[model samples]
Target: MWSDYLSAGFFKAFEASSGIKVNFTGIDSNEEIINKMKASKGRGIDICSPTNMRSPQWKNLELLQPFDYSKISTIKNANPAMLRVGHDEWNFGAKGSHWLPMIWGTEGIAWRTDQWAPPRAGDIPSYGDIWQSDVKGKTMMRVHSGMLGAGLYLETIGKLEPGAMKKAYDGEPGMRKTWQVVTDFCIANKKQVKLFWNDADSQKNGLLNDGVVVGQTWDGPPISMMNNDDPVQYRAPVEGALAWIDGMALSKQAENLDAVYEFLTYCYTPEVGGRSIDGGKDDSWGGKGHGYNSAVLGADQYASDDYGKTFGSVYPYKSLANLWPWPKEPQWYADVRTEYVNKFNAA
Candidate 1:
């Protein structure tokens, strides 16, 4: 989506105005991009969008250069969470700076309002709820490893702990509880889930056409459907939702550092930010509103204009509690995936 827009007159205009031509390239995965950046030893691309989970990895590889805030005046207006300067031991150098939060969202339950009410505080539904006899064969889940890990954590540990909560990652009793819960839920509710979706459109179809009453998903799809007048609702559950950060960072080797800074400044503008929210379609998981909220543009007041009566009812990025920072450890992703795959296959 961003690539298409950048290729349009947007990049041309940006370049003409800033005297910097931005070169955009697409890579398959965060790991691939990181590896490519490391191979260059910090001289590859000017700007990259990698998941926040990779911050520590980039730091370790010395693939990022500290963001020069003095040159980017818009940094002051950004949400504090979006700032790059910070001291996190998990990041490389045991101290790191240089990745700016570009967008964010939570992984949580989305249910058919016609069939269910919002779960009360402390009563947010769990992965186990899908296994309840009443909803058997009527639930859906995301197939992504990160999302599945969160569901597993909620199931086994019953709630999120600040640090790594997986037994494989942290080797703690709480992690054990989380794994147990997820494993039990998957085993018992194997027949309940209609399907596990990897894409946003498939999940929407399952909910709208396949009679799926509950889904473990991100905020965009459910909210998009509801905005289009679908009988669905979503929320950040009491146990807290799995949050992630999608950020923009400069390549240590990027030749057009000035262009990268210009692009970052452009992205922070209200015009660019508003367009991002307005670009959301029902089938896409993340839309303009999702990006705007992640950029911390206050509440989602633009909904009424976008969806009419269907708009105001859907909440997007309203709670910091709902935003779970992605784990920084290198093996976190592989370990969690293995645990869930083992549990699911065993069941």
Candidate 2:
């Protein structure tokens, strides 16, 4: 849905203005990007999106090349904090950034408003809510992330050590110790999950058709549905939304350098960024948008009114300050985490 939305909305406009057609492919996870690029050594893919934390692993793999910043003049329109992440972390050899921030959002709770409400009427839901017997056999989540949320919930209730999830980044021993506890807890309650979503479409289907009363999901998909009058709402949980920045990376063996820079330049424009979030009843490019925040400055001004309202509802009480920013993952951490995920899925 993200690929199609961007292709139909801003990518189409970029084509009209620059005369360069984009061949877009929607990918579900960072592993997919890594595998596809590794198979070809980045030969066929010109630009690919990887979340910010995944940059270190991709950098270690030699799958990406540093961007020539001079060519992307419109980059000045990007949010300074987001740009700093690229410069500080993705600066391969400190020569230049290999990644540029594109879209930013959080993974949190989305529930069927008609079927379930938070335990407290006005309070934000907690990650622990998904485990309660009330919603058993009526929930959905992704394997890896749902376990992370379970760890967070355990932390909140004193079941696991404080900061257990974040400490998983410290080393393999600590990660295994912490994740084992989380895995046990999840396996014990695995019956609660009716579906495990891998992408936005699966998430939408789980909520609207698979009888999911509540689920962990990205902010974009459910918000898109809510705007269309689906009986659903997405909000940051009390443990904080797991935040990440999706980045545009240049392939090491990119064949279309000019087109790559053109696409980045086009994306960094404020109007393009804003419209990507909400197309504002524009029939030419579909009436809706991706339903997430843009990293470009002044992009909000051009977004539809629904964007403002939805933003308020989702981030009420300045919960943006409560976001749990994802820490960079080493290759070892990612590998071990995958093992735990596989175990949970099999159990």
Candidate 3:
């Protein structure tokens, strides 16, 4: 999946000049990939792209190789938020550059323009809106446990209870309120929700087919849909959206060190970074080069024709600059996913 969109020509050009063949393999899921790496005793794969939340597993399994940034030149160009060298011990030692930030984005709402009015500036809708009877069956949401876990937080918004946030994160309070809101919305609007989607393509199709008036989705999908001639719009909402920072790291068992470095270097190059930000490709890996909005180009040469207006206004890059990155706690992910799944199932 990661290799399909990589500019073959760009890699081939690198190979022609560097005499290194990039051996790319496709894996079906994170679990399968982890199993394969473990089975190999950390000797097969050269590099791995894992969520920060999964770092503890890799560290505990001894599957990750400590990165030596002394050999890499692109680290200087990396965004400070994207770089996590000295943050903590689990983060590849304080100075060892094992994990390299790859992409960053937020999870938010995407709605059909035909069905909903454009939200006023600073008036973004939130999870609470999904429970409104008016739009009940008209909504769809991500079924992933990580995303649904956000519901627990949502339920505490208007409550007078103390420690609600901590309770939700701890999975004690559970996602009861969030589930109630979502289930009530879904049940009332049973006829409106055309389908629930687990993938981007499905969400786009739902929006296009008029199956869903609004849905919880990542920033990328709605942007891509609007670019593809769909009337979808995205918003961060008042409650704030979820953010993630995925990074790249070399495997402890990797045999092709030079090839791995070459690949990382290629990814960090200005051209590659620019293309990734401009939506030149689809995969999540490339999109991290630029910020959330497709309009902000690190290099002027890479900007699209309407870059000036489109990048800032539609995407809201300036506002996101101050937002915090998701914490790199593995247990947080586990707890959230579990609570989300439980609440979703109950709903």
Candidate 4:
């Protein structure tokens, strides 16, 4: 897993300098993280990364605790907007932040550069493009998120009301109504997708080996390939990229308090945070960072030469302002979406 590689890289760097060994267990999904933490009562793990949207549920479940920011001087180096998320959104019963922003990223369009390009030069592609007739059976997507992308595309053509997808987060009825249209659209155009990707490796394989010409993929995989001079490019879609922040949270039953704080301080250092963006010179793990933005201020200054060029190209001409952050999701919402996703897949 890319996350495991990231944890390994961090462990190697921190261990070499601090003389403290860190053990890592990689999990593929948020559900797995919740399950493990719940089963252990958060006893075994010192820290775990969960998306910002999961903060509320996790906090309500008493799985995590607020951080003692006094020990983390590097907290001053984080972006203020991101800090507000920890302070305002994830502050569930605690007066302080239960979550600390780490890696932030987006999910958008990626295509084989030699085999495909946007319809017009200088313009970005749209989620609707994935279902275009020309690319039938040559596209790929993860079903759940892809369905949301499809919903956005439907609104663009007057097939659904504007903002219908975002409105679904209001409650269960809205969610079902919105997802019903999305599910129908996906079932009708299911033939367009060559394969469904569930992980980073599957996404890369779809493009590099499985004949996927274009895909709705997380920016990391294709950007990493692009850095290696592979004929692939990832960009924000015309509707907007789906954005998210993945953060570190303290386990409720955490025993290694000193080590947890030490690791947090190490992660926020400018040089370390920067290396995470550019995937530092560590050859053992393919020397590739996760290819996402870091939350730490000044971290970009320490990134590789390719970082600046790639950033400017991928988010050109004010596209950054258009990022659509994922909203906080309740357990009920997740369960409802799972039903629709299952229906679309089963179709």
Candidate 5:
């Protein structure tokens, strides 16, 4: 779980009512949590917040239990767009039996507009922005071997054939070629990269301190910066933002299933979900400000409050066509990605 999601009073309010103590953990990325859950056999975890893309892999490992509608009373509030992304038979079962959509958002470029602006009038931003000569030596990028990096690569090079999502994770012959291209792209631009970051603070502060003119960030940090009058911008590139939804999953070995179920239901309520999205503590990114949007149905009501949008209040929701979740990857693909990640890090 991300601290950015579960804000200050979220659990305190829940505890005051339910008298249940939350033992929480913060995970860094999509890839790391999967490995952690599998290694622990999910011994200590009750509810897991993985993206819809992870449903297939979780199913393959039997890491999660099937959902039963009888246990969830709040399912009706989940809207269509939120439930539909990265969804499938295993996690959703016949009728969404395995998971509940928790938080959803896009990951893409966050740039310093004061330092880096469009090269020409009416020129839209794209993944190619980091490679521009003006922004060189002042760029950063996401360090991922999963869908985020792979999707950007495929989309950037116009190599996203149909089923390209699976190929991104599964190491199809196409994956090798696609990854090679991305690797080459990164290597050629590595000199421009100040750092490849996984820590949240580094990403947010890098932009805040003006360390890099352009780089990768989630929708949150940019919004946070702008709220404080920092001149940062997060936008969908010409290639489109990398979309994802993190949901609550049940661990097979969870000891207190009933309590965890109740907790999930409690959290789904609009007030709690809203507070969770817009929390008491301010991270460098959205919190007290909504860093990004959430999948919880009523949670997004704060769009009217308007965190830091100068273009207008609230994010202009993109077309469903523009978003893509991380592909559900197979084990073989995961292994190949690990190798590629190793090579990438070594480089």
Candidate 6:
């Protein structure tokens, strides 16, 4: 089972071809999925999808089995650049094996273009827009693994030194003050946030139905709103978008192993992946780059025209340089961020 945000539904074509009834489970955040894996002891779940940022935590816990590239024939079609960006395989595992990139995207402010404009503003949206005095009681944000909010808060206070962020995730010296700044900002502006969301529907509802003018959000909700004729836009804030990749991983002890492996490779198929996003366009014109791309072969052919105009995609799939994924660290930073969130939620 996997998160619904990865794809609208499991690929029926794969099921049709393999005669395997693909079972899927959906959740909003990586932390929730991690908790599920822990509670279940990763039993019965043949395969699962998790944001690549969580890969470090998963691998450290030995929660996932080594993905044998020697056997998964379909891996030949995957993006070569993404083969193994992290992990010290030789010492870490038999070969330091782990998950693969399923889909990639960024987190940013989803604004109602009709409701607010940039301060200096023709069109480019900035992360600071969410903190303006006029927007009080009408903004929202998300707790996507703790980093997205950290990025925004750090940028807001001018403490976004790259090395400082790495230290922040690592819980090093001086990072505590930075973390305190963020936590204090959170307490101060708790009332400014109309809501904090974790799933797609909450964000979609917060923006579309609940009168939220500007909120920290993922790319999907704003695009879904646009498709429904809502004037909305998702963009990389001036501080930059928080980029991360999501992909599938096999549990160490899974039933139906053969079917699980088949489903893993089947998902990378271009027709299946491309069609799943952007309402089945399966073409370059799919709804504005979607901020994600397949890790498999022929993914380059699906780049978006709207996003390509701004280099969101190239001949091959890629994320913008300004987009930052999670900082590499041994400890899962969500443990820290969730502490802050719990207090805020209690308020």
Q: By lDDT, who's the top model here?
A: 2
Q: What is the C-alpha lDDT of each candidate?
A: 0.58, 0.87, 0.56, 0.85, 0.65, 0.63
Give the best candidate by TM-score: 2
- What lDDT tens digits, residue by residue, belong to model 5 across residues 79-168? 666665534545444544576677777776778877777553344466667766777778777666323444464565675554554465
Model 6, 216-281: lDDT tens digits are 787656765665567777766665677766777778778887887777677677655554454344
- Which portions of model 6 show Cα errors greater than 4 Å? 6-10, 86-91, 144-163, 282-291, 300-319
lDDT (Cα, tens digit) per residue for candidate 3, span 85-183: 324434654436557766556666778887785345654656555555667677776655223423433445643243343344444335354444544
Candidate 3 Cα deviation (angstroms), residue 69: 1.2
> Candidate 3: lDDT over CA atoms?
0.56
Cα shift from native, residue 82, model 6 (Å): 2.1
Lowest lDDT sum, 10 consecutive residues, model 4, at 1-10
The positional error of residue 121 in candidate 2, measured at the CA in angstroms, is 4.0
lDDT, candidate 6, equals 0.63
Ranking by TM-score: 2, 4, 6, 5, 3, 1
Per-residue lDDT of model 1, residues 100-188, tens digit only: 76656566778887886544553355544555677878888764443454455554553544343534345445545556555665666
Candidate 2 regions exceeding 4 Å error are 1-7, 281-284
- The predicted structure with the larger lDDT, 1 or 5, is 5
Residue 15 local lDDT, model 2: 89
How many clashes does each candidate structure show, in the order listed? Answer: 14, 0, 5, 1, 6, 1
